[model samples]
Structure formats: structure tokens, C-alpha cells
Target chain A: MATQASLDNPPQVPSQTSSTGRGFPTGLAVLTGFTGVMLLAASYMVFVYAPMERTLGNVQRIFYFHVASAWAGALAFLVALVAGIVFLINGKMQWDRVGKSSVEVGLMLLTITLTSGPIWGQYAWGNPWPAWDPKLTSAAVTWLSYAAYLMLRQGIDDPRRRARFAAIYVIIAFTSVIFTYVGVRFVEQTIHPHVVGPSASTGEGDFGVSARIGQTLGFSLLTFTAVYATLLAHRLRLENLSERIKQVKSAVLARQG
Target chain B: MTDRVEAETAQSTRRTLKPTPLAQATLAIAWKDLRSELRRRELVAAMLVFALLSLLIFSFALEVDARSRAANAAGILWVTLVFAGTLGLGRSLGRERDQGSLEGVLLAPIDRSALYFGKLIGNFLFMIIVAVIIIGPLSVLFGISLFTPLLPLILLLGILGYAGVGTLVASLAAYTRGREILMPILLLPIALSILIPAVRATRAVLEGAAYSDITIWLNLLLATNVVYIVLAYLLFDFIVSE
Candidate 1:
């Protein structure tokens, strides 16, 4: 139906003033403001509220935001995977847009988690990048897989075909995300901290979570998730605007001819 | 038409053979590839020569003593296998695209996944042939014992997973521009799950580690193999669809 509609009605360029005057939607703007406030509160909890960790000192504070970013990154990737499956089933460009946007958000979050991880590692273990560590290796694999997902998206010219192939790739690439986050626990040894449920026997940097620390980490996770939501909403808006601009350009070229 | 006559004849032959239609179609596609390959002798030869050359480069670059070669050998072998396998996958699918035969194959009445599994089988066979041939030179050049009983099993599992994913990704990449470069970029990251366990299993087997130790990596390899193959099977239809 959308393809038919676009075929029938050639796009028209909006007035320059109207295009530039478009304001943020009320709901998204509110969410963005709320997320901003929560981020500030979470930062306070990380720096001042949570007690300094005994052994690792202030560097352990990075754990709160670092783990939270990792959680948000995984959630973004999960969103991409679900959106992909939905796009394949229903053949909707909306889900494809959501899927690609989520990957961009996920890649951004993963960059933060990965880069901050080494900072903590440098402080604690005196090694910034541990080459053979299973956790690090798997995390890198996850990052590269999504990066490839974007490359796959770029290579296709047809929107329908791009969406279809990208959806398939998203499904395949999520396995790497699963492996990085969950499967690494099965490996024999990792110097990375596993603070959640049951820390592995040979896991380094294991720490006891006091109530205050747990509360901060919880708040940080909530804030980061909200951040993911806000970022995804903004990304979708940007994509829709770009689509309109492309349609307008094509229409102009056709009229000139 | 001759096409109709051949189709009817093949149909009768398949009915007599009594395999499921999917299996019949799969084997026919694979046999078609193998038969052509037998005549041309191109894909496997290129892969084998590339594998050996990479093997040579590994030995020269590492320049390790015999003791360390045993350790480095698994990494070297898997890397060569991955690179050479990519070569074969690109060519095998690229050939079908360039010759415009893939469209004809799609025009057949078989399920699309039959095409995937067929290509996967053909690629898997080519990789196995290359791997088996390269083992002699690998052991001789690296001066390591690759003759363990478990080595073939490891090679089978590793190549099975590699070719399974490779065939699917190759099809996905073929429609895109610059497929030669794009295939490895799309494949190698996903193949790491297969390669990591594979290299570890090969290393464990080389060191004569206890059976229990190597079983873990073997099982991981098997699990990833099942995952990739099933994913490829379910997803291949959308890839080949118009």
C-alpha cells in the first residue's frame, strides 16, 4: 500500500521555513527532559552517594555506569533483533527504521562500555587491553558484528531489499551479542568482573555490593535505559526527515527533466 | 522441449530413489555442482593452492621453533582454512550469479532452503578436500603431529560450521556491490564462535590433552554448527526471493 501510494503521489518539497520550524514532539521532549534529570541524579549517586570501593577505590565507581551502559547496549541490540523479526513478518518500513536506529544506539552504547571498561581495567589490573581475556574478546566480537550489520545495510540500494537483508543479518548477529554477554561466563577464566548473580570461580575483580552501591547501580541502569529510549526516538525522527528530503530531491529532479 | 523431458526423467528417477523431495532436490543441486566441478576442476584447485600458500606464509612469518609450532599450528591452520574457505564461497556463489544459473535454480520447484543446504554441502566438501590435502604440508612445514584421531572430527565440525555460515552470507553478499571484500567482512566476525572453539580444540588435541578437556570445545563447536545451519536454513528464502 505504501509503495502504491508513493508511486501515485510524487513528493513535494515543504516550505523552507516550515521544514526548519518543526519542533520536537511533546512526548519525546518530555522524555528527553526526564532522562536528562535522571542522568544527573544517577551521576550524583555514582560519585557521592555510593561508598568508595575499598580495594579499587574510585575507579570501581566506573563499574556502575559501565555495567549499566552494557545493559543498555544489550537491550538496544535486543530491540534491533525483535524489530528485525517484526519487519520480516509484517513487511513494514517502520520496523526496519526502528531496527537500524536501535543498532546505531546500541553501537554508541557499546563504544562507551568498551572504552570505559579498559579505563577500569587499567586502574585495577594495570593492563588496559587484555588480548586473550574471554570477556573482552567476546565483547569485541559483538561490536564488530554490529559494525558489519551497518556495512551490510550500506551495500544495498533498494529499500525493500536492504530492509529484508538487514533484518536477516540482525537475526544472525544477535547470536554474537548473546555469546558475548552470556556465553563468556561458561569459559574457564576471565579477569573481568561479574558482579551480578554468581561470579565465576576464577573471575577477577569480584566485589560485594553494599545496599547503597546496589541502589546506585539500579538507578544508573534505569537512567541508561531511558537514555536509550530518548536516543532511539531522536534517531527515528532524523531518519524520517531524511527520507522526506530524499523524496523531495527526486521529485525535483523528475520535474526538471 | 528438452527441459521438460529432462525434468520428467529426473522426477521419475527421484521417485524411484525414494528420498524426500527436499533431500532429492538438495542432492541434485549438490551433485550438479560437484559434477560441474569435476569437469572444470577450478574451485577446489584454487582453494588448495591458496591454503598452501597461506600455510607457507604462516611458517615464514612466525618462524617459531618446533615446540612453539605445536602451539601456533592450530591458529595457523584455522586462519588458512577461514581465508581459503572465503575464497571458495565467493567464487562458488559468484560463479552462479555471473552465469545467471542461480535464477534458473530458483525457477525450479524445490524449497529455497534446499538451495542453501545444497550450496552449503558443496562448499563443505570443497573445504574438507582442501583441509585434508593441506594437513600433510602443515605437519611437515610446522613440524607438528596433526595425525591424532580427533583431528578429523575437529576439522569436520569446524568446516561444517564455516561453510554453513559462509554459503548463506555469500548469497546475501552476492547481490551487493564489492562482494569480494564484503563477504569476509560479514563472515569472519560471526565465524569467530566457530573458529575460537575450533582452534582451542585443535590445540588441545595437538597437546594430547585429556579427552574431557577437548570435549568442551568440541561440544561448543557442535552447538554453534547447529545454530548457524538452522539460521541459514530459515533465512535463505528471503535472500533469494525477488
Candidate 2:
């Protein structure tokens, strides 16, 4: 059993050095550059190409990036959920790293979604914060849930135990994400419009998306996915470096003693 | 030698065929908690007094007249329950940690799910007792009779859901450095999903709405209760494991 445990978690020194020496792989750099260009193009399409809506006019352009960010946030959370489950099942530190990094990025993107949502709401619905909006409320709730997950992580000291608790928590928190996406529709009345699915309702401030607008939305979502991937890779590398530093510091202290 | 081997095989087979010890362990743990509570009366007293005081504060803050109180009764009831229930939950687990009894419990030869369900039952019972105590004062103070049979049923479903998630979260929080402060922060957002439907159902029942009108919320409450209980049961082992 001891031999198996050691073999499973072989000394981390060589791999860390080799990866760090490579210093930012070409793939990631290319992906980041591609994402930057696509994001710029998407913005141009939103401003110059898509026709102005008769209802909300040019302010409706925010919907393209706003909805794209929401989608990306949900997708990131889903990645965290999957990674969490895998970590719990396999007890792998790499999976935990993936889960934590994804959650951080997801939380940042969701903040953008939540903030942009109100700006759009103010111009479109004439209320900066519509109390009865189901989508808005659900987004707020999901954001709080993940924020709690991060806070819980901060309070635990043992890396293994922290990862374990976070794994269980993110899995549980994913249910709230699902609820935010679908639960509002179950309530009797909601002012938030459903842009997709069979139960899409034309609520206040909803406008028809022309073909050009749809293209822009799709392009923006794809660009955000690329950005999410690049960010997650960089965050994972940072965590590995930090872990390596801790190991080296402990080894040096032992030698000095 | 053959006779002895045959006898050993028979005993091992009989042991394998017997029912698991899970049910008995769950009951024993729950009974132990209740008996301890009966002797000390600590958790229940705090929860009850805190709940009553919350009602007092809400009344003053809202300046709730009889009509307005009636309208806000459901929201008031759930808010009071959540705050009081959180207090009870934190104290209940915090005691085990403070006394170092949690380690002993884990060391016992029992399944972890049994420990989880045991805590769930104990927490559920405490919340229900507090809810029952608050009903009388709520009735007299708000000038509305809140003693309907349906009200208790709704409270039971709601408290079950709350306690299901609460017991698991409390155990997790109890291990943290900021156990007391972290419990509510971790609990409230997740519990909100359960509380929303519960508050809706309670309001419908309070207003004497038709059964059909409130059925959906009741169903939601039941679903949330079962989902949380099962999920917590399956996941408790992970949280408690080293």
C-alpha cells in the first residue's frame, strides 16, 4: 500500500521544472491571440453590422456580449462541476486544480453578466434592478453560491482536505446553477425573457434577434470559450508553480535543521 | 475436521444473510442526541427564545398592523424559522466539536450515513419543536389563528428540507475556523431555493387559498426535501472522511 501511494504521487520536482522551463507554450499563445481577434470582430459586428432594434435601439447591442458572458459563465461552472466529481472519485490533485480555476473564472464572468444585466435592464425595462425578474434573481443567487464556495476554500488550511470539501461543495452548488437556468420559468410570473428553448416567453424588454445579431452572438460565445480555456490553463500552471515553491521551501527548512 | 468446517460455513452464511446494522445505528445515534437534549435543554431554549425575539423585532421594524401582518405572516414565519434553525444547527454540531466527541463518534464502528441521518432527525425535531412553540405567540400577537392542521404539515416539510441540508452543512462548518460565522453564509443561499416554495405554500395555506392553488408549492417543497436528504446522505461520507 505504501509503495502504491508513493508511485501514484511520484516526486513532483522534475515535471514542474520541465514545464516551467518551456515558458508559455505556443498553443496557448496562439489561442489567446485568436480569442483577442475574434472578440474584437464580434464587437464590431454588434456595433456596425447588426441593425438597430425598433424597441431599445442601439443599447440592445449589449445583449450580444451580455448573454454570451452568461453562457460562458454557465459553461465554466459546468466544467467545475465535472472536475469536482472527477476529483472526488479519483482523489486527484490535478482535478481539484481544474475545478478551482474554473470556479474562479466562472465567478468573474458571472459578475460581468450580473452587472451588464442591470445596465441593459435599466435602459430596456426602465428599472435598474427589477425585483421580480427571475433570471436576474437566479443569477444573483448562483453568484452568491459560488462566492460561498470560494470563501469555504479560503478557510481551510490542509490542501487535501480543502480540495475534498470544495469538490463536494461545487457538486452541490451546481444544482443551484441549474436552478438559476431553468427554475425561473416554473414560477407563475417572470419579467425575464427566455431567448431559447420551447418555453421561451416574450417578457418585457425582449426583442427579436435579426440574423446578423444571431451571428454576432454566436461569434461572441465562441470567442469567450477560447478565452475561458486560456485563462484556465494559465491559472492551473500558476497553482502548480505555487505548490512547487512550497515543496522546495519545506525541503530547505529540513536541510537547515 | 469436516464437521467443524461445515459449522463455520453455516455461521458465516447466516451473518451475511442478516440485515445491515444501519437502521439500528441511526436510531441509537438519534436517541442519544434527543436524550442529551432532554437533560440539558440547551439547544431548544436558545432556538425558542431567539425565534420569539426575532418575531418581536420584525413586528417593530415592519410596524405591522393586523392586516399587514396577515399579508406578511408567511414571510415572517419562514424568516424566523431560518434564523432560529441556523442557531440550533450551529450549536448542536459545535458542541460535538468543542467537547471532542465528534472524533469519538467517527471512531465508532458505524456507517457514516447513519451518523448523517441521525443528525438530520435530531435537527429536524428541534426545528419542529421551535416552530410549534412560536405558533401560539404568533397567533396571539398577530391576531390570526395559525393553528391549522395544514400549517404544521407545511412546517414539517419545510423544516425537513432545511434540516436535511443544514445537518450536512453544519458538520462541514464545524470543522472550519469560522464555524459560527460560516454556517449561515454557506446555508442561506442553498436553503433559499427550498425556502422560496415553502414560503409560498405557507402563504397560500394562511390565506385559505384553495388546495389546488397551493399544491404546486407543496410538491416543490416535498421534492426539495427528498432531494437534499438523499444527496446529503450519499455525500456525508466524503465530508467526514479523513
Candidate 3:
């Protein structure tokens, strides 16, 4: 076994079963919390101080947190995809858990993003139910793909084989979102207009900001990023525990044999 | 420590052993599957009959007016092909797996990807034949001119992509516990990118859209097929390894 003192040296993988736990540090924690406080302040600044849009009104205010949640979810998805690649390369069961947990968390945030988007849609676009909206359609598909990922996992029994297959499968599903998101850009001219009422699709390019609103929006985004990191830390730990339990159970069975 | 190095060495040795070339192995396995299915003729007959029935039902439910016929002919035809094609896919792999030929093929020296391609080709051929049968009388009944060149190209590309993806999805479904229900749930969404382009290109061809209008859809369809083929090959080894 590797020495504890030498762990401070190069390339040492801190064991998962170590009593003190494996990831993150005290200073990092304090800093992340501080940054999170700063972000919360930013959210307040945006909603309270940011000037309302002349057309879309206060409903457009959700764009800051809205975009941030969506951003973090997309970012988490990329991380999960990377985790999947790592799982495939290493064939380690832990990476599979990381992939699964990250996806679950990502799905939660994406659900918020999807829900919040339509609510924002109803207030700002004058119609909450636009079937042809690319974002809505694409997000629905992305959500479904992850749901499909869950089903794929449920279908397999062997941990290693399941990890390997899910790794490959998720990577394939993830890329189509990129295609779908951008597919409209190519055909933007022909897209179905906001048929139910007035058009709010014109907002993609409409970014002008009051100073207070800007700072608040910026802070809200920061807050969520910190929140995303914190949630991920909690999830990874839970996964590590379940994994340890599995290994310990198997080990006991083997020793009994 | 000693066990790890020994296992690694053994795995390395396995890697260096000669494996069959992809094309020759693919053609050989496909030929084998086609020959077996040809001898039985059961899958083809069932799929053809199923395709006809689906068309008939659609005609009745749709209340097939001439205007509706003009607009819906392509969509109905493709939808019929899609539904009928699933039976061919499910039954083809389902039978192979059930009969124990699956293991015999796995035991062969050839790479497992060869099996994927071979099955895909067999499925593609069956779909094309079914399309021909479904089109002839359905076209007469519906007053559709399904005889154009662009239409054939659209059909061929759509079938190739669908069959290619379907072959792998079917294999995975065969191994998964719920072979019947799990297929469409898994296949349709994964197959969506391909399906969208397939529908668009087929519709464009039928609607007499400008070639330029249809070109991008065709290219995207082609890319979808290529990506699925490569991904399916990468996945075939894992899905079939056990």
C-alpha cells in the first residue's frame, strides 16, 4: 500500500476508502462558500436593480438565472460526457457512478431550465405553448435522451459491462443536441413564427443592461455555478459510498468462500 | 501485483492474434444470415404482409381523399415502411439469438462488427423489397407516382441508415431483458436525427422541392448514416462480446 506521507507527492491517487475522504479541501471549501455568498448578492442586485425590458417586462428578468441554470446543466452534461470517456478508458466502476450521478444532477437542473423556460415563455412571448420553438424542442429531446440513458442502465446487470455500454451510448445521444440546437440557425429564416400571439423569439440578440441589473445577473450566475459545484461534490460522495458498500459486500462474500 | 502483469500480458497476446478483415468478414456473415433467412422465407413473408396491412389500415383511417392522398402519400408510405421494418429487425435478431446461431457466430474468428454490417444489409434488402410491394398497389389506390429517381434515392438512403442503426439496437434489445418493448423506446429517440432528415428528404422529393432545398437534407441524412455506422461498429464489440 502507498504511504500516507508520500501522498503529498506526485500522482498519488488518494484511496476511496480512506477515513478522511478523498476529494476537495478546507481552503477550497471556504473559498467556494465565499464565492457563493458573493453570487447570491449578485442575484439580488439583478432582480431589484436591473431595469425592466421595455417590451417583455419583468418576466424577462428570469433570463439571468434561467441562462445560468441552462448553462450549468449544459456544462455538467459535458463533464458527464468526459466522465463517460474516462469510464470507458479505465473500465472503472467509479467513473460509471460519477457519470450516472452527474447526469442525474444535470437532468435536475435541465428540468428546471425546461420548466422555467416555458414559464418565461408564457409571460414574455405571450404564449407558453409554442411547439416549434427550437430550444423547447431540443431541450425536450435532450431530456428524453438522458431518460433513455437511465433505461439503458436499468437494462444491464453487470456493472462493468453496463458502464462500458452506457458510456458509449450516452456519448452518442449527447451529440445530437448540438445538431438540434444549431439545426435551426441554418434554417432560421423558415422557422414557424410565434403563431399564437406577438413574437418574442426576437430576444436572442436583445441584450442591453442597466449596471445594477448587470451586476445582479452576473452574481446570480456565479451563485448557481457555486451551487452546481457544491451539489456535484455531495453527489460524488454519495456515489462513492454506494460503490464502497458494493465492494465491501462482494469482498465479504469472497472471504466467506 | 503478479496477477495484474500476467493478465495484462495475456490480454496483449490476444490483441496481436490475427482477426479477420472487416469487409470480407462482414460480407461473409451477411451472406450466411441471408442464406438462412432465404431458406426459411418466414421473416420476409411476414414483413411483406405486415407492410400491406399497415398500408390498408392507414388508407381506411385516413379517409384517403385525393388531396389528402397527394399530401400524405409519402408520409404514409414511409411510416408504413418504418412500422413494418421494425418487425423485420426484431424478428431477425430475435430468431438468431433464440436459435443459438448467435453464439456460433461469436465463436468465429471474425470481428463482431462484421455481424452488424451483415445484418444491416439483410435488413436493408428486406425493407427495399417491402417498400416495392407496399408502393405498387398503394400507389394505384392512392394515385401516387412513386416511380421517380429522387424517390428511390431517398428510400435507399433512409432504409440504409435505419437498418444500420436498427441492426445494433435490435442486438442490444435481444440481450436486454425486455426485448419487445425496450426496442422502440430506445431506438426512436436515438434514431430521431436520422428520422427527421429521412422524413424531410422524402417529403421534399415528393413535394417536388428544389434540388437545392433537398440537398442539405440528403447530406445530413448521409452524415447521420455514417455516424451511426461508425458508432454501431464501436458498440458492436461491447454488445456482442459476452
Worst 10 residues of 3 chain B by lDDT: B1-10
* Candidate 2: C-alpha lDDT: 0.80
Specify the poorest-scoring 10-residue window by lDDT in model 2 chain B: B1-10
Give the clashing pairs for model 3.
A46-A216, A50-A213
Residue pairs in clash, model 2: none
**Superposition error at A106 for model 2 (Å):** 0.4
* TM-scores for candidates 1 onward, in order: 0.90, 0.91, 0.82
Model 3 lDDT per residue over A33-113, tens place = 886786667666656767777767788777777777887788778888999888877777778888888888888888888
Query: Compared with the true structure, what per-residue lDDT tens digits does model 2 show for residues A132-209?
Result: 466777788889999999888988899999998998888777775554346535755777776665444657876777
- Tens-digit lDDT track for model 2 on B1-242? 11211223434444344432787767777787898899999999999999999998877777667566656888889999999999989976788779877765665556778778888889999999999999888787677788887887899899999999889888888878788888898888888878887888888888888998688888877877887888898789998899
Off by over 4 Å in 2: A1-18, A199-202, A254-257, B1-20, B65-71
TM-score of chain B of each: 0.91, 0.89, 0.88
- Chain B TM-score, candidate 2? 0.89
Model 1: TM-score, first chain: 0.87
Native-to-model Cα distance after best TM-score fit, residue A27 in candidate 3, in Å: 7.8
TM-score of chain A of each: 0.87, 0.89, 0.79
Q: Write the per-residue lDDT of candidate 3 for residues B1-242, one digit (tens) a residue.
A: 11211223334444465666778777776676677778989888998998888888877888767655655787788778888888888876788788866766666556678778878988999899998888797787677787878888888888998898888878777776777777777676666666667777777777788998788888887877888888788777877775
Error of 2 at A23 (Å): 2.2
* Of 1 and 2, the candidate ranking higher by lDDT: 1
